[model samples]
Target: MPSGLYRCIYYSKNRIDGGRTRIASEIESILAAARRNNPPLLVTGALVFNRGLFAQVLEGPCPSVEKVFEKILRDPRHGDVQVLGFEAARERMFSNWSMAFLGQSREDQNLFGHIGPQTGFSTERIEGDRLLDIVRNLAFEEEARAA
Candidate 1:
């Protein structure tokens, strides 16, 4: 019997620069696969750094998603990837998203800061920003970096 799959979305922040971008480079291939019409386990996510903080959102199967996240945190650039608030979705939120997302904000750092700690990192590592603003800024910065 196959285990059930889930869609999990959470964000984390770290006190570092270029870390998110470097992670981005590493995930370029995975991201491309995620952008496909449909992929197995449907894993996709991103990480974005701003003001000495790196924020990210990941979505996919529970086990596979967790595995990918573990690999990301071990990347030396990531630290304390605390869960902001993840839901076991009936399906994918962004059919176009996979692995990890970069440059997004926590939106409610205070709320996220209350979720306790995971992997020795506290919710205190959260960032405050509007979701739209974070995504937009991240898109711009990523483009500039590529140029």
Candidate 2:
């Protein structure tokens, strides 16, 4: 890992209003922008959206990660954005992906379900490192599936 490498994990309430199709479109647009912007900055991450909430991990040079996260904070599509963690990291977990999206497949649903069983998915209830591990695993699984 480089000297300034860092990882950030956050979860936000989904504020994009519309039917499923519109929401899907918005999420796709987000991914498109991320894919376009991340490579130049050497940022890599995974994003998971479960209709009501969005959880994501970003790993890269510290300045680059901070820049991306600042944009995310200002984006209108996200509300009540809560950063779970932001700290120096020793390694890159999503190195193979600039931005990997975990969708609504059965496997993804099961992954999300395991997070919060009784009270549902609550950012307040989950720790940053745990979320990072989950997203990292999902991204690797996705990569394998694609391969």
lDDT against the true structure, each candidate: 0.49, 0.84
Per-model TM-score, in order, reads 0.48, 0.89
For candidate 1, give the lDDT.
0.49
* Worst-scoring 10-residue span by lDDT in model 1: 112-121
What does candidate 1 score on TM? Answer: 0.48
Best by lDDT: 2
lDDT per residue for candidate 2 within 1-147, as digits (tens), equals 469999999999889998888888998899999999999999999898884789999999999999999999999998888888999999988887888888556423646677787435573777787777777777767777889
Model 1: per-residue Cα lDDT over 1-147, one tens digit each: 234555433444543346556644644644564455224646755545444445555556787677666665665544555555454655543444443344334432432222335322242543332332354455556556759
Which residues of candidate 1, in runs, are more than 4 Å off? 1-3, 13-41, 99-147
Each prediction's number of clashing residue pairs: 16, 0
